[model samples]
Target: MSAPANDRLFRRWTSRLLLSAILLGVCHPLAAAERPNLVFILTDNHGAWTLGCYGNPDIRTPQIDRLAAEGIRFTRALSSNPVCSPTRATFLTGLLPSQHGVHSFLGGERPSAQMGPDAYCTIREFASLPKILKQAGYVCGLSGKWHLGANLTPQEGFTSWITMPHGATTEFYDAQVIENGAVRKEPKYLTDLWTEHGVRFIEENRDRPFFLYLAYNGPYALGRLLLNPARNRHAEYYADKELLSFPRDTMHPWQFHNKDFLNNPTSIRRVAAEISGVDDGVGEILQVLQRLGLDEKTLVVFAGDQGWMGGQNGLWGMGDHTRPIGAHELMMQIPLIFRHTGRIAAGQTSDLLVSNYDFLPTVLSHLGLSDQRPPQSPGRDFSPVLRGETTPWENVAFYEMENTRAIRTDGWKYVARHPEGPCEVYDMQADPQERFNQFGQPAVTDKQRELAAQLDAFFARYADPQYDLWKDGRSKAGRLGGAAGPAAAPPQRP
Candidate 1:
């Protein structure tokens, strides 16, 4: 055993170890990256059919349509609730309003603290999407609307936020904005300003994995059109504007109240214009990512907080579910698109029913992180579907508002109103418009009963006893108060 022979053997073993480490580094970079950059773009009051990719003839959403062209689009997507705060909360925590307890708009119905016990506060106990991602070593940033609560200083795991305060009045230019808790005046339009902040966040965090929640409050109420009392001022100011318009055939009853000046062609065009402004902002954000060469590596998602009635059932805004003007497909169906170059299938459409609650899980799965199961969350990760893998997602998607709850399967939808109201059942395959309510009809009575049973079981399984109006009296108290209710009360300072 010579000393030189022993030394040569040791050197060879060391060289092999070094080579193995380099190979592992090159092959599993995502392990070191450990977090994927997540950009979740959420729009307020933007309906599913407003984009060109969604088969709308008039809305020129070139930026969003482009993303769809390069990503997978879910044609039958929906929101947990058809409102802002509750829906956003559901998306973040993967819990329905009944569980999260932010069932209505913030400051529009109940005091923030009374909404639930501190342990059940939507933003408190629930692990938010940004919060979870941050724990996994991702920088978290939020831009645009922060309707969950005015105090958006990352209490639930965000690092930076540039947001509009609760119930901030919408203006095209010179709107007030809050940047990281400081009240600031921004000269640009609301949507554009949010886009600027989002782009800046991306630029600054391009070197690190990050999560950016860009929640836009455009094309929603209090916009340029709704800001005018007469509603005539909108058309008068933007007259002859070549705004994109959906096909008249696609326009529903809930879009306008009547054939008055409020529902005139010009007013409709103005609504379209406001949406165009949001679309332009979307383009700016996308362009910024491309310019920074982060487009391919980043996972970008575009979705609306919820669908708007517009005028489907002679309704202008979100209607009371108890006496719904329209609860048809148009009012609930929203667009969900995911774009990650070479990861998600391009130019594809998935009929797999998806809800906003699925967003956090799917994003987490795509980033190669282990899924976190929240207590009693009903959402399932759709990463398999997004990856073009066949998934047997036979579970029905559930939606609720006030005293009404609806359940939709692949072929049928059943809606039931509590406190004694006529239930409705529709064969979505045949009556996609939901013009006919076949509940109690001799032909579909059995099917309706079956669906009702399923809905009942779903409620029993997922509905929190604390928030369930059918079981608890608190829900009734909150709804009856309306704008002056406990649910609408502002949050008390901690």
Candidate 2:
């Protein structure tokens, strides 16, 4: 059988993105040429591979796809980590998880390091994107998941924080939400509630340069789908679709709770429909920007906090057994779309090897707050790349979560767990699905050794003596079967 016409059409159009320029003629805001308002749309556990623009004909993401058509999209955008909280930290701080230290999902508990006054989650430590932007005459607001630490009060960077008290909730209807310092029960859908708050923030701050860190609890929180009235509202949106029709018949792209991926993956259609709710929110937000004529003066960024694995690489979800830790592609490759009319060229795509680590530095540089960044931050300013400017860029990016460590270059990807165990090496040029692990193959022995050494050296700098996954025996294999807790097993996901 031949491939779909849309895929072929997408390929032809993809070829022209880098070679094309989309010129827009809109009246610039009074403060537009200076500091444009920024709306950062961050989603939880969204996979980059699921979008229609990314060649997934099954999933419907027209709102996000349109952003790609109107602005630059990245072919090689990755999450800093495969989990949630850590990746969010990187986005705010421009530093990797190892440096900033929000390692796993903050589940109603606090890390020992983040205890008491001047904690990292309380908006201390390094200056986050919101802090710097706020200092530079931008009113910053966050209206969604703020899963960095224990206390969920409004932090320093944000002038307004309408957030969820618990990191995550199974609450679909009658959910409790915190606004500024007050808490209330909202009977509306979670996505709509967040969108409502975001739209309000945008409307209130449209007259000036503002920063809205709009995060959503859409498709990622999967367990509550049936309980969620949203399921009834959206299930029929994809009623005609079947799992086999999707790019991979493996699993759902997003799961609400970590355990949602434990069983066979949920229906892809239902998952896509869940995302459609998020799309609806995005559409509403975009409409507001256009209606207020703030579209030209605002920079809209849609990104996933981190990617999730749903039976990719035979790993059922995000935990143990075949899932292991950090061996698959979906967990790291998340969606990233940037749109700013009159500034960034439209319909542009590039394989510039960007990661969540690059988000803050790039935002800083674009907002003219690069000087505020700490000297030791690990991020690079890639605003030029987004503007379609040619600049020397990274070819390899590093990743780590708990006991796992990985490095991916243009040609290959290497993943390994620390303190002795199995390792994976994939020839990315040939097998992007990562079906084969060639780490032990004699043909790639030299390459494996080179990557192994580089991985070790790269992590060596961030290695903490008190808790080093490699040296302190933190890996599941290092613990040698049961009793290592979540870190020791495949059943409980981190």
Candidate 3:
């Protein structure tokens, strides 16, 4: 009787233990999905003011506008660099171009040769964004322009990539594309192709948490045509005739040279059309997420690589550092939107001073991953702000071009140039347009000196180690195939 009773009691206890173990296993954090799927949609040279949600009355970007309406839009976002390749490098490596060393566009073999060995041979030392995410068990994919380097594939973390070796021209039809490593011809529009690959990547990885980097080459260029060309049909249809009636405002005295080109009716129309095309492409991606039922569990980010002058401040393109081109907010400010259906709050705006370098840390924080060891990057996670747990940021956003650097705080912007160039300070609250220069004003000299010291310290800590291009005598002139002079010749209009 004792042996039978003891055996029955042991069996009951064993069964209870097994059931409890199973319940705990199901409740474990690791047993659930590790992290949300991340979809980063980046556009090239798209200004913040070009979208409908950004208050551009001429352009129709319903899809991007919808993302803004459904997510959080940072009104004062910026890029580390004003150019494409350097800024893209900053976003990928979480280090500024001065640190990563790819400070200019990887246009083609010829340009690479002209730039010298440092520009041609520098590989990123820090972990790229995809690599970091991929190491954390997320499948990574990239589509569209890979302007970082011409020969490099998606080696760090991207499991699959369809990127153009050279910058793709803004063409709605018969655009050239590179798949993986080989060049492939694609007949569809450039934006459509980019979105297509992004959607396909999501479809393929629906079962696993994935990161899709869709870089669209749109509204940036209409095949070397500056500020939009007459050939752009979409711009023609969407052009706001009333806005066209206003006089063109050139920011710098030198910018008057490009006023005619900026005011050309054909160019304005083309620019508007190209932006519309990009908007449609964004819509396609949102539709795909909805159809796949992955909307709620996915975090979608829409950002521009850098800002464009678009005839603002009298500059036709970026890299005109002779004047205060890159220092202006219009040339450095970018639009940033993060949307997560139920996870993130909808339709909010953050005026916090944030930059592209903050992207990697933000993504890692959102995934609840531990911060990487050694503190290899300068960016900080803004997840607290995104979660509605914090108020405005206490930091200032920094900006850099070849030999120029600037810092923007909440109410004041301080900029300094190298080797005795003009230093300017602007009261943003009083002059958002930056028309007046206040560097010599006795009232703000102390504040200006403080900001300059901060900028100097920042450069000492974060600027590129190999060579301080800003301090060195070597100039960016003749670097972009333009003449070596005080000012590079503006692009010729057709």
TM-score for each of the candidates: 0.82, 0.82, 0.83
lDDT of 2 by residue, 1-494 (tens): 01243245434433342122111113333332368889999987677767777877766778988888989888888876776677888888777656655556665233322224533453254557876666556788888888775344667568788887666557556888876566788888888888999999999988888999998876663454533233536767567655443334444332324434343335455567777788888988999999999988898999988776544543433422233455467778888888999989999998888888888888777766565564446677889987889888868888877666788888998887644445788999999988777878899988888887777777676543333444443211112121123333331111
Once fitted onto the true fold, the runs of candidate 3 whose alpha carbons sit more than 4 angstroms away are: 1-33, 108-123, 168-172, 221-223, 226-236, 239-247, 256-260, 319-325, 471-494
Residue 325 displacement (Å), model 3: 5.3
- Which pairs of residues collide in model 3? 98-464, 234-273, 235-273, 251-313, 255-314
- The root-mean-square deviation over C-alpha atoms between each candidate and the true structure, in angstroms, is 11.6, 11.4, 12.2
| Tens-digit lDDT track of model 1 for 302-368 | 9988886544544445544323433566667777899988788798899888888777777767886
**What shift in Å separates residue 258 of candidate 2 from its native position after superposition?**
6.7
List the global CA lDDT of all models: 0.69, 0.68, 0.69
State the displacement of the C-alpha of residue 29, model 3, in Å, after optimal TM-score superposition. 9.0
Global lDDT of model 1: 0.69
Candidate 3: minimum summed lDDT over ten consecutive residues — where?
Answer: 485-494
- The candidate that wins on TM-score is 3
